[model samples]
Target: MKIYKYKDSVYCDEDLSCEYDNYAGDLYDLYLDLKEDNKCGETTRYYVCDKYTGYDEPEELIEEEFSDLVIGEYESED
Candidate 1:
């Protein structure tokens, strides 16, 4: 997995078996950005995930956020 800090938000490259929808991270930051700019809707979903689970629903993903987690070393491109 590749993690990128782009545009004040952290993005993680995900292998979700899809070509287009392959990134998942910084969801909470994005929600805050949208809310701060008054661009979010009432039905908009919010999340705070630091790990990947390959789940489709937000509720299930959030549930597995902290289970059996491991820290990995990620080198920066600076």
Candidate 2:
């Protein structure tokens, strides 16, 4: 399946962290904890990379299911 890959320097940790893969989904507010804590945060810029994996579980996949905003690839991380 397609997923967002972290490609930011530092600010990614501020807003993008904690947002789940399904965070792009809608079930979050329906059942997850911190129901009242729902609010759109600042729109921080982020970089993106496309990666495909067949594994049911990926390595870089967050252990706690977090999100981190990123900056797009201006200069290659390479």
Report the number of the highest-TM-score candidate. 1
User: What's the CA error at residue 4 for candidate 2, in Å?
Assistant: 11
Error of 2 at 14 (Å): 19
lDDT measured at residue 69 in model 2 versus the true structure, 0 to 100: 27
lDDT of each: 0.37, 0.26
Writing each residue's lDDT as its tens digit, candidate 2 over 1-78 gives 123333222222223335443333222221122223332211132111232322223222322233332223222234
Per-residue lDDT for 1-78 in model 1, tens only? Answer: 334332344443333223224334543443344446553323344333432235454333323442222122244445
Which residue pairs does candidate 1 place in steric collision? none
Off by over 4 Å in 1: 1-10, 13-25, 43-78
Worst 10 contiguous positions by lDDT, candidate 2: 39-48
Instruction: Return the number of clashes found in candidate 2.
Output: 14
